[model samples]
Target: MDEKRSVRISKTLSRVLRHDPASIGITLDEAGWVPVQTLLTALGRKGTRITRDELDHVVAVNNKKRFAYSEDGSAIRASQGHSVAVDLGLAAAVPPAVLYHGTTGAHLDAIFREGLRPMSRQDVHLSADTETAVRVGSRHGRPVVLTVDAAALHAAGHEFRISANGVWLTDAVPPGHLGRLAR
Candidate 1:
């Protein structure tokens, strides 16, 4: 498929898998997986006809590795970034000494005071590299990268998990653990 079409399908998949499976007449289990055949049928009913091969291609070539198939190939789910209340089944892992969060400059004041909360999502998403964080921040506005003291947070009993796609996940990053990175 062409890039535009693939992206459209990917976005639809993300919406169904991460936020609202009910919109497509499906449900994600506690671990956030839905049977592959059920997903395809629902997509068909919803007027988005994606063949198995095309789905496989999307899963394989998505830039962010956003979707993952179950080990037996019978199910699929988003790797992370869920807005609905489904567990991702990720184990807690030690983060690096530092991690990065990207956002627009406009949010800095609130962040400085309130810390980085998940807002609407389940966890605060973080990046392992500044460049990726910058890219993510660019989506909101003028990008600002913030450094996170991951080791310190972990030492203080904050849990962290690296998603299958490598995005860092944590409940929140209090302001005490954050510092503005110099541009």
Candidate 2:
């Protein structure tokens, strides 16, 4: 598929898998997975009409690696960023001493004051690398990077998990554990 078409399909997939499966009349299991065929059928019912090959292509080429196929290739799920209630079944993992979160300047004051909350998602999304964080921030506006003291958070009994797409997940980041990362 061409780039624009691929991107459009990817966005639709993200909307369905990460945010609103019910919008298309499909329900994700507790672990946020739906049978591949069921998702395809639901998409068709919604008039999206994505084919198996097209779905495969979109999943394969999504820049963020947002979607993941089951080990047997019969199921699919978003790697993270679910707005509805569904555990992603990701195991806890130790994060590095530091991780990064990217956001627009508009949210900086609030973020520093209230700490980083999930907002609409399940967990505070973080990135192990500054580059990914910056890219994520750039989406909203002028990007600002915040270095997170992951080690401190972990030591404080906060669990961390790395998603299939490499995003770091934590319940929240306290203000004391965050610092502006000069970029």
Candidate 3:
């Protein structure tokens, strides 16, 4: 499939699998998985016809590694970035000394004051590298990267998880633990 079509399908999959499965008349299980066949049927019904091979290709080649299949290949789910409540089943892990968060210039003031909250999602998504954070920030607008004192936060009793896609996950980052990296 072409990049445009693959991206469109990937976005739709993100919506249904992460944010609103109900929009497609389906539901994710507690761990955020749904039967692969069920997902295909629902997508077809919603006027987005996708074959199994296309779905496989999308999961295989998405740049961000946004989706995953079950161990037995029966189900699939978004690796992270869920708006709705769903346990990703990720274990708490030790993060590096630092991490990064990316956001637009518009949110910097509030972020500096309030720190980084998950907002609508379950956890504040973080990146291990500045470049990845910059790309994430670019999606919103003019990018700004923030350095997070992950080691300090962890020492202070905060928890961290590494998602399947390598995005760091945490409940929030207090202002004390954050510093501006680039604007």
lDDT (C-alpha, whole model) for all candidates = 0.95, 0.93, 0.95
Listed in order, each prediction's TM-score against the native is 0.98, 0.98, 0.98
Clashes of each: 0, 0, 0
**C-alpha lDDT of candidate 3 relative to the true structure:** 0.95
| Candidate 2 global lDDT | 0.93
Segments in model 1 whose C-alpha atoms lie over 4 Å from true places = none
**Can you write out model 1's per-residue Cα lDDT over 127-161, one digit (the tens) per residue?**
99999999999999999999999999999999999
**What count of clashes does model 2 give?**
0
Error of 2 at 6 (Å): 0.8
- Model 2 vs truth, CA RMSD: 0.8
Candidate 2 collision pairs:
none
RMSD of each: 0.8, 0.8, 0.9
